[model samples]
Target: MRLFLPLVITFICGIVMILHFFIPHRPISTIGDGLTDWYMIVASAAIFLGAANLVQVHVHRINTKARNWKYSPVVLIGFIAMMATGLLWGVEETLPFDYMFQTMIVPMGATMFSLLAFFVASAAFRAFRASNWRATLLLASAFIVMLGRVPIGGMIWKQIPIISEWMMQVPNMAGQRAVMIGAALGVVATSLRMIFGIERSYLGGAD
Candidate 1:
């Protein structure tokens, strides 16, 4: 009965959304809008639940003295501080929330990304090794693309930028469109499967 009810709701909502896109009639549109509002409410509730779950897990870690448990307190403190400041003063400009976000969060995010650049470079170096013809081609293309973005490429050869632009606009765009089309087709197939109740994995157990 639990699974049946969820499947029924999924089918109804899926059908309604599909109809909403095609029909665009007044009643269907109204129902679709209401469903969207309900979805937002549910999403907000899910986020709250997720935050609670995070706190629970971290508290358990701290209590158990698990590996790296010392970081758990930092996580909890940051979460509580952010929540308190936002709830108390609101997140407007010049407020405590905004001040902390800009001063602390932004710099932390930038530092994380800066560290990621080294990882990316390491991965690229490994992947771009000219082991074969295909690898050589990939390495060459990546090199041209990277060099084209910098001033040194133009200084070395004026045509580098032009070739890079063509590679991006032509081959790269084609690949992107192919991937997008494939993804859209996959989404449609999955949605149809869910609508037909053929996909029951979302209900928790195996389909």
Candidate 2:
């Protein structure tokens, strides 16, 4: 009954939402908007549940003295501190929440990305080996793009920047559009499968 009810609701909602786009009738549009608001409420609840689960898991790890458990308390402290700050001060620009986000979170994120750059460069070096014609072409394109971005590139060859720009606008854009279309089609297929109850994995073994 639990699985059946959800599947029915999913099918009905999906149909209504799809129709709402084409029909454009007042009541159908109102229903679609109301469903969207309901979705927001459900999403907020899910986030709250997820946060609670995170804290629970961390606290259990700390109590058990598990491996690398020392970090669990830090996670808890940061979570609580952020929650308290937001609740008390409001997340205004002058508030502690905003200050911590700007000073602490932003720098940490930037540092993480900086570290990732080295790993990405290592991977690119491995991938750009010129064993095959395709690999050679890719290596050349990457070299041109990287060189074009710096002052030394223009010093070596004035046309490097123009070639790099053309490659990005033409080949890069075509590849990106192809990838996006494939992803959109996949999403549509998955949504349809769910609406038809063919994808019951989401129902927690209800299959």
Candidate 3:
């Protein structure tokens, strides 16, 4: 009964959503909007549950003196501090919440991304090994793109920028469109499977 009820509900909801796109009658559109509201409420509750679960696990780890448990307190403290700041001071520009976000979080995120750039460069070096024809092509393309973006490229050869722009506009766009079409097809297949009850994996155990 438990599994059957959810599957039926999911199938009905999926069918309704699919029909809602094609049928724009006032009542049907209102119902679709209501369903979206319900979805948002459920999503918010799920997020709250996840946050609670995170806190519970971290607290348990700290209590049990698990490996690397010293970091758990920091996590708890940061979470609590953020929540308190938002709730008490509000998120106004002059408030502590905004100050903390702007000063600490923003700078930390920037630092993290700056560090990741070096890691990306290292990975790129490893990936750009010209062992085969395809790899050589990829390496050459990457070199051109990088050089094309710089002032030195124009100094060396004015045509580099034009070549880079053409490569990006033509090949890159074609690749992106192919990926989008493939993803759309995959989504359609998965949705049809769920709507027809052929996919019951979401009901917990395999069907």
Candidate 4:
């Protein structure tokens, strides 16, 4: 019942959400917005689950005397500090959060985002060789995009903008639609598996 109910709800919600985009009718639009607002509230409530899991994992590691367990201390302290700063000092002060946010969290988040650049470059280098016709085309497309985006490339080659525009309009649109179709199929398959009780990884494993 637990599994069946959520799956049915997800399928119905997905249909409503998709239709809401095209229909533009009052009732369907209202239902879609309500579903979205409900999601936000539920998501806020569910964050406690993530916070609880983090504490549990870190505490266990510390208790077991794991190597470099000191990071857990930093995590715990930071979590508590942020919580207290928000709950205690609050919006009136605004100093603590702004200080920590601007100096610590923002930089850390930006650095984490920056790390993706290196990973993407590595992936591109490995996967984007011209060993075949398809690979060669993909590599050519990516090269045009890279050159079009950068100032020096634009300076050196004035035609980059025109090529980039066509690439975005034609190839990108085709790729996007293909990706969306594949993704939709995957979603339907997973939802079906959940509905049929075939996928219970979320309920935690085989007993």
lDDT string, candidate 2, 93-182, tens digits: 979999999999999999998999899989998999999999999999999998988988889999998888888999999999999999
**Candidates sorted on lDDT, descending:** 1, 2, 3, 4
lDDT of 4 at 85: 84
Clashing pairs in 1: none
Q: How many backbone clashes does candidate 1 have?
A: 0
Estimated TM-score per prediction?
Answer: 0.91, 0.86, 0.92, 0.69
Runs with alpha carbons beyond 4 Å of true place in candidate 3: none
Model 4 C-alpha lDDT per residue in residues 11-95, reported as the tens digit of each score: 6887788788898889999999999999999999999999999999899889997998989989998988888887776745357
Per-residue error (Å), model 4, residue 196: 7.4
lDDT of candidate 1 over 1-207, digit per residue (tens): 888899999999999999999988899999999999999999998998999999999999999999999999999999999999999999999999999999999999999989998999899989999999999999999999989989999999999999999999999999999999999999999999999899998788467
Q: Rank the candidates by TM-score, best first.
A: 3, 1, 2, 4
How many Å off is the CA of 179 in candidate 3?
Answer: 1.4
Range of the 10 consecutive residues with the lowest summed lDDT in candidate 1: 198-207
Runs in model 2 with CA error above 4 Å? 204-207
Model 1, which residues run further than 4 Å from truth?
A: none
User: Looking at model 4, how many pairs of residues clash?
Assistant: 0
